[model samples]
Target: MTRPTPAPKPSAPTGTSAAHVPLRWVGPLRISGNVAVTETEVPLATYESPLWPSVNRGAQISRTVDAGIRTTLVDERMTRSVLVEADTAETAYAAARAVHDRLDELRAITRATSRFAELLAVRHEITGPLLFLRFEFSTGDASGHNMATLAADALLGHLLAQVPGIRYGSISANYCTDKKATAINGILGRGKNVTAEILIPEAVVAARLHTTAARIARLNVHKNLVGTLLAGGIRSANAHYANMLLAFYLATGQDAANIVEGSQGITLAEDRDGDLYFSCTLPNLIVGTVGNGKGLDFVQENLTALGCREDRPVGDNARRLAVLAAATVLCGELSLLAAQTNPGELMKAHTRLERLTGARDAR
Candidate 1:
């Protein structure tokens, strides 16, 4: 009998062992939009095995239609807020006015920090003697977290020199609202604002999803809209947007923490005749094509596979990536909502898939 080999020791830090999560490519999802027009399989890395089939179901439905999932780029901007202190509110107000007036100079300063960072807007709020300046920028390709922060640092120095009586308080004022569930990101927008929508025929819905258009639409109103409101969810009305977002973010090497605000979105469903019109509007879908995590071997391969690594204009690749992310969100959201429409279907699928995964692990 052959002797069993001992488990290899981890070369990484003790706590940072190479723990693996199961990753699978799901769906040659047909997506049509201003940014991307392709049938692509998405890579999702997650322990939740049910998501793969759930999203695959939605993807199958997409292919039945001519246009498939339609993703639209609503808006795009990355923001960073810097804090400064003045002697009085009057001085703070003066500094804010000066900053607003010298927009050209500030744009130059922001550009000097990074070739990709371009100043889009500058918003300021003054309370007592404190000034919070939120600087929004268009960062090309990269997600623009570090880029925005670096630009904000340089802009802070410039503001201190040009605007008198305001000294540095902090680099981030929480007004940018990065990685946290806040209404500001939803209202003013922080990252990629993309909406993914699909119109499923009544026959397809009943055949694939085992539900009717009216049932799904009514469920959306009662469960997603009203339930979220009753729960006091801030700027969010959706079913399991974070589930798909996290899986996609992990596979594509995005800042996974961004799912906090990335998950804040609305699910709109309508009973159009007998067809089902499902849409997901994600205002804070933060993703990047070339960033910190893109250097990873798997991330590079995944981006290339997704066609996000194509040599496009500065922001085009990132926009394509954002649109893809939004479409994936819709796929998962639609499938889960459809499953919930039938009693015990959701739990049965979860229990069955998770058990299969566990059995495989045991093997």
Candidate 2:
């Protein structure tokens, strides 16, 4: 696989509104790296800072909740169209599927590496005689937006070279739906559908967060569910899953814009025996162990500190990173939910954290 380009730099530093202060290390949330779970406060300090070199600080509320990560690598699809000059749209779609089935039969002859893209399904759109072939692949680990594209190219070449009566209309068809939200991807899922769940006890919610599970459930029902439905939202119905995802992405080397899909998540809660079973599912989490700015000094150091810089099976590392990201999202989600349980807590925490950090830096 080709190396992914570097991640962009963090936006211009803010005066007091900056979400993070340079050299501020946020939490050893889990028993990560050399830090124990008890050392939840600033376990991994920002690496290679000029001023706050020795001191370590954590993403305050982020350190409280526990998160668990799980990764899934399913087929992400893209389109390679074939020109089927047929009498009608019905015939055009049939023509594309027939070619796909033929290719499926000859898989034994066409495939070289197991990594060679396998066609999962064939979908088509009919514009009179023009037929668009949207092919799906069971791409592993690496978000195969580009992988599927390359594989589609090769597959199209093979079809044209070998298959008779398979005329080509185009290869660069957008049906594969790269980097955008589509209903198909939402249902089938694209990239790593990483889910992070935490069962917060009633006692902990009451004592630490000043909230009740019943209230949490009610809030989600009205705000996330009904509110979003009323507003005509698509797919997701959650509270600020993107906040944590974006913060983590900026720290790590990832395509920040992918938060578009990453943010398309569902935050669900159940009052399980008085405890809140909170989970966030980011179906379109596109992250990797390698690629992007993984080569950067700061990003590399952060990954190492997060214990994500390790050798594992081919897709294991990337999946691990996905889970970690999901876990982080859960942490922030839980914390913010707790804060909102009591009015003004969110801004108050901001006042204490951001304003104080800004004040400290100015000093």
Q: Among these predicted structures, which one has the highest TM-score?
A: 1
Instruction: Show model 2 residue runs off by greater than 4 Å.
Output: 1-24, 31-87, 103-121, 125-130, 138-141, 160-172
Please provide TM-scores, in order, for all candidate models, with all chains considered together.
0.94, 0.75
Worst 10 residues of 1 by lDDT: 10-19
Q: Which candidate is the best by lDDT?
A: 1
Cα lDDT listed for each candidate: 0.91, 0.59
Deviation in Å, model 2, residue 34 alpha carbon? 23
Give the per-residue lDDT of model 1 (tens digit) for 1-363: 999999997442321112355678889899998888899999888888899999999889999999999999989999999999999999999999999999999999889999899999999988999999999999999999999999999999988988889999999999998999999999989899999999998999999999988989999999999999999999999999999999999888898999999999999999999999999999998999997988876778788999999878899989988988888889899999999899999999999999998998799
**Model 2 weakest lDDT span, ten residues long:** 50-59
What candidate 1 gets wrong by more than 4 Å, as runs, is 1-19
Q: After superposition, how far is residue 91 of candidate 1 from its true place, in Å?
A: 1.8
